[model samples]
Target: MLKRHHKTEALILKASPYGEGHTIVTALTSGGAQLKAMAYGSRKLTSRIGGHLSPLTRVELALYKSRDMDIIKQAQNLESFLELKNSLSRMTKAFFVMELIEGFSNTGVGNRPLFDLSLMSLRGLQSSSNRDIEDLTVSCFQLNLLKVTGFMPELYTCVECRSSLNSNNYNFIIDIGGLCCTKCLSGHPGRAINISSKSVEILRQFDKGGTLFSELPLGSTVELRRLLDSSTGFWLDREIRSRRFMEHMNSRDIREPMSAIDMESV
Candidate 1:
């Protein structure tokens, strides 16, 4: 028998007006399940749970399990991630993370790693101020997200022939979901994107949690971003809406110069 009333910790992914004074919230529960609940009267100014239910907030929620949907009975915020809210650039990236998570997650399917990665990525966006670091944060999150969700790209071998990619001459095919060796690239024409040897190394490092964006050159960062963007889009079947806004912000804002290491030629 399922409990009628229950409580769980959740990261609010999206919140939107439902009716006059109610809100429909989509959240990722700590137990690694996606949840959509109705927050009655939350749109009212005096409602107890109104402010606590905003998107990207981490909150503890008490819910009533109705037949149609869960109802949020009470709430308490756990982490507001205030620093991210202060910077437009970081906040946009944070939204992009949330959007990507939504694309990959399914309701009632428990994926604890996905929930943890989402929290860690948001916290990373909160603390970093550098544009390059922010870019890496999102990029790494995308890579890790793909790994946790079972879409990890094949970096070490040819997806076509299963031959060793020891020579480092490879092309990443988005539709095939992995690398195709140079020898096999001709058979699958048009979709293969040339991947450099260094980029391959960086991706391998990312897979094993061995590298950081700061340790690599800016050019590599840019390269990885393009690769991941295409990869993620192929999986989601639609572009992340927040990405365009984030790129526009990047182009318009002036920030500190890249550090000496990042400026090194790739």
Candidate 2:
């Protein structure tokens, strides 16, 4: 018999006290899998691994398989995201984004694109110069996360009718998972998210991996934010808890909570 040693690059998503002197750490490994590992003695004052295991710190780890959970044998800090930690708003946004990633992800399955996106998004949030840019970064991250995870809303046409929209204003139906035409909305009872053509055009660019922060259209942030938030919650089956905290930090109002059917659909 041999001990299983798994080595990976991981982002520490969360950590909680466990046992007398250990911590239960939730990490997103480089392969894009969520792993819960026990870092024994991490709570001790002299522990070396404790410093490297802080939330949002990227590190390389050697994990030994245990009966119920993995045990960390080695940890090397990769990126600490120090700037994000300096601001409550930024860090809360980081948590919100990571929470979304964790919600969509499953254990033991790898999604490289998503892993890279999450890392890049966190760095963007940390290094951003101001709140507006930070907001844009989070929005971009949400939109892109949905894209990578196969939950992207269809913006090109109506989800219900599958018809190309040629109007300056379109309705975003979270229940249907994308834009809806006036014709289709007549048959649908859910609240239709009104979006400008400019917003839709910019979002198309966003989906193509365009500039995230400095390029965001003025006055469209709220609309875009609500759209992504609504659709994401709709698909995920519940409102993301960190969203409220992030919005509070930003002083932005959340226009719509989850709709009745939106709650039922997920």
Candidate 3:
């Protein structure tokens, strides 16, 4: 087979320093494949594509294919998602969005649905006005991501018993991958956390556009966040890298907007 030159639209997933002035750029292409390319001189002040290659920017790239990895020859920025980078909350959530996509994606496989989900989630997080909305946005994205990847947990029925979960008591069992009815709880015997019916209803609303976000109280948001955090953590088998930072910042009272410089560095 012969190597060829190709062009594609990609979102920069990672951009790390590689040799002296070159960088290793990992991107998720529009076709949903991971493209790892070396961008020569991208780290230097006067470099041509230096500004275009940062993580989370959408760009078109000219690549030369190789058995080892593709080499990026030219680049042009399509969108910087500057609005997302303008606030700490937005930036942190954006990073979390990217990390989730990157984590679930195969190294060289194409997953256009997952790719589109990532873009949509980023845009949603950017336009959100309040922290509550922002939190809902992230949870919505997580549930959709699970659906797209075929990991969505069961909500309406007992996962183990194949019976309807119409009763008042239901516990979400991470090990069994869904809610277990009170009658079925004794069968699996792993850690089961009791969940409220309100939480269940709200999570189920995710598949239907999640219009309940605005009406949800602070306690509901906290409950939903905890459920997602635990379920996602259980599935991924590790803590989300962006979670600690997001949680730490979330715990503080930074109601006033942060400076632009801090937003960029975040």
lDDT tens digits, residue span 26-60, model 2: 88888888889999998899988888998889999
> In candidate 3, how many Å is residue 127 off?
0.5
Query: Which 10 consecutive residues of model 3 have the lowest summed lDDT?
Result: 257-266
Off by over 4 Å in 2: 1-3, 213-218, 252-266
Q: Roughly what TM-score does model 1 have, to 2 decimal places?
A: 0.92
Alpha-carbon local distance difference test for all models: 0.87, 0.83, 0.83
TM-score of 3: 0.91
Per-model TM against the reference: 0.92, 0.88, 0.91
**What lDDT tens digits, residue by residue, belong to model 1 across residues 1-266?**
98999999999999989989999999999987899999999999899999999988999999999999999999999999988987767877898899998888889899999999999989988888687888888999999999999999998888879998755566889888888877888888788888777888889888999657576776777788999999999899998887886786688753544345422310
Top lDDT: which candidate number? 1
Model 2 scores a C-alpha lDDT of: 0.83
Which lDDT tens digits does candidate 3 get at residues 177-214? 88888788877676888878888888888976656367
